[model samples]
Target: MKKILVITLAALLSVFFIDRSYSKHNQAVIQKTLINEIKEHRQEPIVTIDFRKLYDFKWDEVYVFTPGTSLKNIEQTLGFTWLDAKSTGIKNRDDMDLIVFVENNQVAQYIMLPRKYGTLQPMAQKGNFMVKTS
Candidate 1:
């Protein structure tokens, strides 16, 4: 009886570990997909003559890419509600306002813009829109 009990416990442990590993693998796949989509769309090159031109990129089609996270999950994790986001109103700009259901500082997200019009003041400007965590 002791031998049987030990074997059962070992089997259960093995199953637990297997399940955990499977879950991690699934999560990784999803993350990779999200990153790829972002890079392909959000990070695309700019080639336009107007302010709204940047929205022509493939990434613009994807309004939101919640990576394994729901609206409620974001609110709980970041401790806030989704506000508003919009364009910067610049020419050939791809900047985006990522209004979230959370505060800033919880996440680090940014975009690099051109050095034209001296907007960055003698330096390359990168906009950072992180979830403000207080």
Candidate 2:
């Protein structure tokens, strides 16, 4: 009976330790994934940025705008579009300034990942950062 209790206590302790370790390393692991994704998608120079660096800048949701898609399409994809862009003489899809959002200095998210530019995936399917027109 004593042996059974000892084994059960050990098992519970091990589980608790493992869970704690995972929680402690979660942020670092997330950062690594972001970096890898950016490296995979980054072309030539690899234009990368971090969220904390651009904390001064606010952003909207990450919107995917494919060819044949219009502003309305972007609005739908992003859930919000720059109403001012349309009114402020900022016309044309190419004319819109889209900034990629990164975390821990990695390109973790963006609006578009054109094959010509590069294919970028976020570390997490969803992150704390976002892309928007600057």
Q: Which candidate is the best by TM-score?
A: 1
Model 1 has an lDDT value of 0.34
Query: What is the C-alpha lDDT profile of model 2 across 1-134, one tens digit per residue?
Result: 99999999999999999976774475345445545555654553544444444334334333234344455654554444544323322234442233344334333344323234432333343433332211
Write model 1 residue lDDT over 89-128, tens digit each, in one string. Answer: 2222343222221113332222322222112111122212
How accurate locally is residue 42 in candidate 2, as Cα lDDT from 0 to 100?
Answer: 55
Candidate 1 Cα RMSD after full superposition onto the native fold (Å) = 14.8
Q: In model 2, which regions exceed 4 Å deviation?
A: 1-44, 57-69, 80-82, 88-96, 100-134
Name every residue pair that clashes in candidate 1.
Answer: 82-100, 82-101, 103-131, 103-132, 104-131, 104-132, 104-133, 105-131, 105-132
The TM-scores of all predictions, comma-separated, are 0.35, 0.30
Model 1 spans > 4 angstroms off: 44-134
Whole-model lDDT, model 2: 0.44
Query: Which candidate number would show the highest lDDT if scored against the true structure?
Result: 2
Q: For model 1, what is the error of residue 3's alpha carbon versus the real structure, in angstroms, after optimal superposition?
A: 0.6
